[model samples]
Target: MSVIIDFFDETNEVKEEQIEMIQGLINLTAQMEEVDEAEMSITFVTNERIQELNHQYRGKDQPTDVISFAMEDMGEGEVEIIGEESARLLGDIVISIPRTKEQAEEYGHSFARELGFLSVHGFLHLLGYDHMTEEDEKVMFKKQKEILHAYGLER
Candidate 1:
């Protein structure tokens, strides 16, 4: 169960503890879901950068709190098959730092809690969780809350 994680961003103000927590979230999400040799990338960006990404990737043209682009097929919690001899790429998680700050204040939660929730939510999507339907939202939201709670990030 090896996971390769890369964090890319130009900001220098992010706390070491926050970085550690986000890395821990990746490991915990992969471990609890039993993924094999997963790889993920996380990028923290400002509103402008995230807005460009949202417009290009999702065609929304707005900055959201977080976005995830999952590459692997999660196979309903069964054996997630990566091609033989090929490393599994889970996906990329892009977070808007400014938006996160605003949402944290708006929702009346700690910045850490909001960030952790977004990280976990994005990780779950990499694990094939979707919030499109009611049932799917229930499962995804429940898993997100559970993981955040397990890490003491729950509101």
Candidate 2:
């Protein structure tokens, strides 16, 4: 599996360790989902920046931990191949660094774990997973936990 993660750190608050961990999670998610070739962008922004995005996109003024924009309308358990050398553009994930830090503290977990969770959560959304309903939440959250645990990023 070849997953290209282009990270744009607008906040400059992301640590090197977090970047490595996120890359690992993305790769693992892609491999687990059987996405042979794919590309996605992860952008780390400030709370203010994320709040703006939240308001503009989601119609919520508060800053969210993460937001995902998926390019393809894939069905569940489906992986589409574009080409061998070319990878599918899987869309973007925007994360609020300050919100992530606050949530990590609030949840009483390591920063790495929280970051990993958020990354995996956003990746799952890109893969056509959602938690709008109870059953959807169960499936999505279960998958998220499984991916994180497999990556050794447990709470």
Candidate 3:
């Protein structure tokens, strides 16, 4: 299994260890999910940028902690066929740095743990995991916690 993550910190407020932890979390998420040869992008941004994205894509005016745009998010009866050698192109995950800080303080966890949670949460979204329903939320959040714990980012 190969997980390629292109990380960008537009906020420039992230520490070096935070970056490394986020990257490791993404890789661990992929490995735990048994994804083979996938490429994903994670971008850390300010609340303003994420608010713009939320309003534009999700039709909300407030800033979100993390937003994921899946490349293979297909409609009903829409199928994406790929070969074995082709890498799956998972879409982008944009995280809000300010929100992360607030959540870390609110949840009484370390900054790295909050960031790792968001990173794994977004990665699960790319793999078609969602929390729209109670059952789905349980599944998605459970997987997120497992991956974070495995990566040593447990709260």
Candidate 4:
């Protein structure tokens, strides 16, 4: 399985450790989900940029920690062909670096942990996981926690 993560740092404040952690979490998430040959993009942006995206996409006029945009809605036997590679376009994840830092301090955790949480959370969303409902939240959050703990990024 090949998981390619392209990162764009608009906030210049992202740490090296955060980048490494995001890559590791993406790989681990892909492995656990049995995703072979997938591609995704992660962008670290400022709070203002993320707030604009949040309002535009989600209609929430506020800065969010993370947002995910899935490329396609596929079911059994459904495939999306991109060029000739047959690679799965998992989609994009945008994170607010400023919000992440604030949340880390608010939650009393390291910045790396918060960043990892947001990355894993966004990756799961790209995999069709949702937290809108109670049961869905339970399952999604459980999987996220398990993956993070296994990656040695515990709360």
Candidate 5:
């Protein structure tokens, strides 16, 4: 199993070290999830850009920490993405730097931990994990905690 990650710093807020850290975190998450192969994008954007995306996609005008666009959505049928070199195009994860900073402060955790949380949360969504219900939320959150702890991104 292999995971290919591409980083785009659209807001110019993400540092090189941060990218390295998040990339490792993502790779660890994918390995833990047992994904065979995947190619996904992680884009760091400004609050304004993220808010616009949230409004257009989720019908929410507020800025969110992260938003994921999965290539293989669970529709009536399904959508299989054929990425470069036969790697599956799992999805794109867009994160708001401002929101991440605020959330890290609010949660009293390291910025790296909050960033990992958001990235893992987005990645889990791409893998079809959701928290739309109480039971599902528990399952998803427990998995998140386990992944984070294993990655050494705990609070």
Candidate 6:
């Protein structure tokens, strides 16, 4: 599995270690979810851009820290096979850098930690994991915690 991360926006404050943390989150997801072959893109956008996306996609005019567009949700027995030349487009994850920074500060965690959390949450959404109901929230939250713990990011 490969996470085709594409950083955007003018968040030049982002450090190399943070980028590596993002990659580490991807590896943790692949290992925990048993995703053999998958490809996803992660893009960082400004608050204005993310607000537009939220309005267009979710009908929400406010800017969110992150949003996800999932591709496929295979069942347990479903087979995942991809050609060597073909990279399945799993989905796209768009995050608001300014929002994330604010959240990180508010949550008393590192910016990298917040970024990892958003990325993992977006990836899980792509896999059809949602926290709509109590049971669903329990499951999804547990999985999120596990993935974050794997990266040593606990709040």
lDDT of 3 by residue, 57-131 (tens): 999999999999999898689788777777899999999999999999999998888888888888899999999
Better of 1 and 5 by TM-score: 5
The per-model lDDT (C-alpha) reads 0.84, 0.90, 0.88, 0.91, 0.89, 0.82
How much does candidate 2 score in TM-score?
Answer: 0.90
| Candidate 5 vs candidate 6, TM-score winner | 5
RMSD of each: 4.1, 4.0, 1.9, 3.0, 2.1, 4.3
Order by lDDT, highest first: 4, 2, 5, 3, 1, 6
Candidate 4 residue spans exceeding 4 A from truth: 74-85
Q: Considering only N, C-alpha and C atoms within 3 Å, which residue pairs clash in candidate 4? A: none
Q: Give per-model TM-scores.
A: 0.88, 0.90, 0.92, 0.92, 0.92, 0.84
lDDT of 6 at 154: 83
* TM-score of candidate 6 relative to the true fold: 0.84
lDDT of 3: 0.88
Candidate 3, clashing residue pairs? Answer: none
Which numbered prediction scores highest in lDDT against the true structure? 4
| Model 1: per-residue Cα lDDT over 1-76, one tens digit each | 6678888875555688998999887777777788778788989899999899899978998889899999775546
Candidate 4: Cα lDDT at 7 = 91
Q: What is the lDDT of residue 131 in candidate 3?
A: 98
lDDT of 2: 0.90
Model 2, 1-155: lDDT tens digits are 88899999998778898898899999999888898889999999998999999999889989899999898876689898676667788899999888888999999998888989999999999989999999999999999988988988878
Model 4 scores worst on lDDT over the 10 consecutive residues at: 73-82
**lDDT tens string, model 6, 9-83?**
455666677778887898789778877667777788889988999999899999999999876766579887666
